[model samples]
Target chain A: MPIACEETGRALTVRVEGEIDHHAARQLMEELSRRLDAALPKSLTLDLGGVAFMDSSGIALVLRAYRRMVALRGSVTLQNVPDQAAKVLKAAGVDRLLPWNE
Target chain B: MKPVNEAKLTFWSRSANEGFARTAAACFAAQLDPTLDEVNDVKTAVSEAVTNCIVHAYPDQLGLIVLRLRLYPDNTLEIVVKDSGVGIPDVDQARTPLWSTGGADRSGMGFTIMESFMDAVKVRSRPGKGTTVTLRRRIARRFPG
Candidate 1:
């Protein structure tokens, strides 16, 4: 997985690419946590446009991000969700827990 | 029904193999000419099953994990993932949605996702023995325009 992170005016955007399974999700969670803690942004936006595939592990990643943001008193949203990833999120009902940037 | 095609793979219960197993299953499933959705569904289900073996079945040490694939004439794909490790004590609780002992990072929705994507999912396990997950799905035959 390739992830790019940038911050603009206290809002951080992390764009992830490639497949996300339990294997990759472990690294992703660690990296995201490190970045979120370092940046302490007012809000976080995850861009998944480049992701080719995802599974239930994606849900854990998102939930971890949400929980981390909550602890940091920040907000989080997901954007550019692909069809395949969207199906998993919808199936797990994570689509209802977090807001998506259309 | 007898399978017209079949394949088996054995690998260690390592996280890296998660991708390998799913990709391998998808590759084998290609012969069925499944749609992109169908292919993704299979890959996702396989990932979940394999992850269970890595995370739950063999939580501590490395162990052997086996994946078996079969295709029937009716266009059905059957995938069997077997692991000989610490088995589930309660299968019902394990299958419940959002029920995971995998700590904070786990959503405990692996079984739910597999069930949603696959046509049928059967889980058989024995404590101190191992666990086997069988998933089956039918691919809709599509003719090119």
Candidate 2:
């Protein structure tokens, strides 16, 4: 997984590319958490336009990111969700828990 | 029903193998000429099954995992994932959505995902004997353009 972070004032945009599975989620989570801690932005947006596939592991990763933002008193949003990832998120009902843009 | 074609793969239970397992299953299913959606569904279901083996079945150490693929004359694909690790004592509770022993990072929706993506999912396990998940889906045959 390749993750890129862009900081624009108080908001941070994270672009995640490639597959999200049990194998990749760990590294993705660690990298995302590290970036989140370093930025500590008031608003976070995860860009998943480049994601090709995701399973239930993506749901957990998103929830963790959401909880971290909640703990930090920040807001988080998911954008550009691909069709494959959307199906998994929807099946797990995680799509309703957070704000996501198709 | 007898399968027209079949194959089996045996590998160690490692998280890194999750992608390999799913991709292998998808590749095996490709012969059916399934649609993109059908292919994704198989990939997702296989990922969940293999993930269970990696995360729960062999939580403590590495173990063997076997994946079996079969093709039916009816354009159906059958996949079997077996792990000889610690088996689930209560399959019912384990099948419940959002029920997970896997820590904070796990959503515990593996079974649900498998059920949703596959036409049928059957799990058979015994304590200390290991677990086997059988998934089947009928691929839609596309008409000639």
lDDT of each: 0.94, 0.93
Docking class of 2: high
Worst 10 residues of 1 chain A by lDDT: A93-102
Expressed as tens digits, the lDDT of each residue in A1-102 for candidate 1 is 478998998999999998988888888889989999889999999999999889888999998999999988989899999999999999988788889976
Please identify model 2 stretches exceeding 4 Å from their true place. Answer: none
Worst 10 residues of 2 chain A by lDDT: A93-102
- Per-residue accuracy of model 2 over A1-102 as CA lDDT, tens digit each: 479989999899999999999888989999999999999989999999988889999999988899999999998899999888899999988777878876
Runs of candidate 1 with Cα error greater than 4 angstroms are none
TM-score of chain B alone in model 1: 0.98
lDDT of each residue in B30-103, candidate 2, tens digit only: 99888899999999999999999999999999999999999998888999999999999999999999999999
Candidate 2: interface RMSD in Å?
Answer: 0.7
Of the true interface contacts, each candidate retains a share of: 0.79, 0.82
